[model samples]
Target: MPTESFDERFTGPTLNQDLWVDHYLPQWSEPARSRARYDFTTDGLRLRIDADQMPWRDADGSFRVSNLQTGTFSGAVGTTRGTHRHRLDGLLVETPQVTRRLWTPSSGELEVVVSASADPTCMLAIWLVGFEESGPEDSGELCVTELFGDRIGPLSSTVRVGIKAHHDPRLTDDVRDIELPIDATKPHAYGVRWSGDGVDFTVDGQVIMSSPQQLAYEQQLMIDLFEFPATEQREPRNYPKTAMVHSVAGTSAS
Candidate 1:
């Protein structure tokens, strides 16, 4: 296989007319302090934040450093079905709180958790902060490109998981609307893989979304999640959902 270069497309919240594609993370410089640990044996990640520690702001849309500290939620590891459910902690964005946590940025793995709240707009994502630098204006180099797709629903397209970059702190406006085709309602697993060429989203070890010639850096492993539309409830539906995480060992194909 031919080596793929870095891909840094932007499609979330664009600045001016920029498409705001996904950001690239060099393998050596990923954010490890933000990674979370998943109890694969239990099918969920260990949320460390307490219920009372949740922040007071709304954690929807784009998030910045200043607001990142003000948006989070918490709950105990409640019980459901015949097993223990994952107690949500930290910031809650959108409906079914789709969020990411890097247990060790230094490692090649990341945990992307999804909780399908009761709302219909499902918390498609929680928070995302990627790194990218644009070339001189008009230098014929638009480093970012928009992702294409829709929200998760009967009429929605398959959701694509990835990252983004922000040059400012205020996140009240729509940065951009880069949608991807990610089907989160099937009760299955999805993820993205990157190498020297580009980034790819996969489900059950099957590649789904491929971004060729769109790599921001080499050796960088980014993490992201997706949630479907639900009601106002913060808890996910009792449908035997699974929390899938990629091994950071870099030895196997996820």
Candidate 2:
């Protein structure tokens, strides 16, 4: 087994503020709007998106999200510099973030014990994204696991795992979706063992996918629960949609 650097069980009366920031891309959306709606219970961290919750970034679209990140850093406000800038048009920072790096490992084995909500409009994802402190080209992502509720079945689900190049030119997108015999609404361990050689994606201690592309930059963990807007076929309801995280553990490469 790899030597563990940290293990967070969420056995808390409150969240460990020193290790996590309960917001999703606050630099682009502002803290009040990006703040996550979550709580800790015997089941661990329960991230939820209520029916009445406002969209994360109104300019982006009508989607709401609750998330936690191990680190955050960005340039001055109004500057187009921040982690995970998805649009090519550029994203101005709404608020400058004080650099925080609770855990940023260059190469590691990171895992999360998690379960997704059954609502088709919701999605649960755990990923490691570049801190982008070294350079904008470092903003790649290693998607540990991504499960959309619509892809989930009673006894099987389509799990997405791989690398996202984003702004990182050295990397190419290699994401893939594989059908697995498992109930996504139930607890499962999703993980990734990454190094300069490549990355291996795993589920329930078993390797599900492997890639030859290398991502050697420092990366931070990001856990998110998203709720898409109501479509013509699916209307919004008052029921709360939630994703539960039983634990998160990581072992840095020696």
Candidate 3:
């Protein structure tokens, strides 16, 4: 195991303010269509998405669901701190004018024991993103774990991992939907090790997907337990599906 860098076990009654920033946010800008549906319990960090919950309208005039990240970002529409652009490369990238704070990690291994929501309209994801002050080509992402609802089967579910190019020439927009041995809705440890030229993903210590591309830039951790209503159809199998995170631990050799 790599030497300990940063670890959060969610043992307290609330989230550690020093390690996390609530929402994607500055509340003045990207307000939710509704309110946060989370509980930081001794059992873990519980995140929920309710179909009946209405989204809160933002100043941008869009209603959004609950969202949060381990890092902080805020700025204007086109303002940048360093070299990153104010907009995306036609897809999703950082929004600079509204972004301010970012905490990038050194080389490390990040592991989280989590249970996903059963709703197909939602997904539970843990990933890494470039601070992107370096520019858009450097705005690649390492999706350590993305558990989508539609991908879940009766016995098991497929989790996608690896790099999402996002206009980065150095990355291969490659991702694999690897079938896990257990039901994703049950608590399981999903991990990613960033070593040399590869980012290996594992489930309960078993290697599932290995991406050959290792990003050398500074990256920050991001956690997403959200519902994309656009991804849903008919009535949900269940309402207010919650994603439970037992812990998020990071260790580094540096």
Model 1 over residues 1-254: C-alpha lDDT tens digits?
21122122212232111111132111111223222222323333311211111222233322111011101111222311110011134422222211222211211212233332222322323232221112111011111111121344443444434433222232122223334344444334444454446555555466545544333322223232223323333442332222322221222122
Give the top-scoring candidate (lDDT).
2
Task: Say which candidate scores most in TM-score.
Answer: 2
Candidate 2 structure, TM-score to reference: 0.95
TM-score of each: 0.34, 0.95, 0.79
User: What's the lDDT for candidate 3?
Assistant: 0.66
Worst 10 residues of 2 by lDDT: 230-239
lDDT of 2 by residue, 1-254 (tens): 21238889999888888788899988899777799998888889899987667788888888889999988889998898887887857579998898888888889899899998877889999989998988899989999999999999889999999999999999999999999999999999999999878899999999999998988988879999999866623334654789999999998784
User: Candidate 1, which segments miss by more than 4 Å at Cα?
Assistant: 1-41, 46-53, 56-118, 121-158, 162-187, 214-254
Q: Rank the candidates by lDDT, best first.
A: 2, 3, 1
| Candidate 3 residue-wise lDDT, 1-254, digit = tens | 21236677878677676666566433233334434567777678888766565544323332334555555443445334322222433322233333433346546788889988767777888877776656656767778899987887669899888878765788888888887667898888888887566788888888888877867765667676766666325364556668888888876554
Selected candidate, larger TM-score, 2 vs 3: 2
For each candidate, the alpha-carbon lDDT, in order, equals 0.26, 0.88, 0.66
Clashing pairs in 2: none
Candidate 3, position 66, lDDT: 56
Scored against the true structure, residue 29 in model 1 reaches a CA lDDT of 14
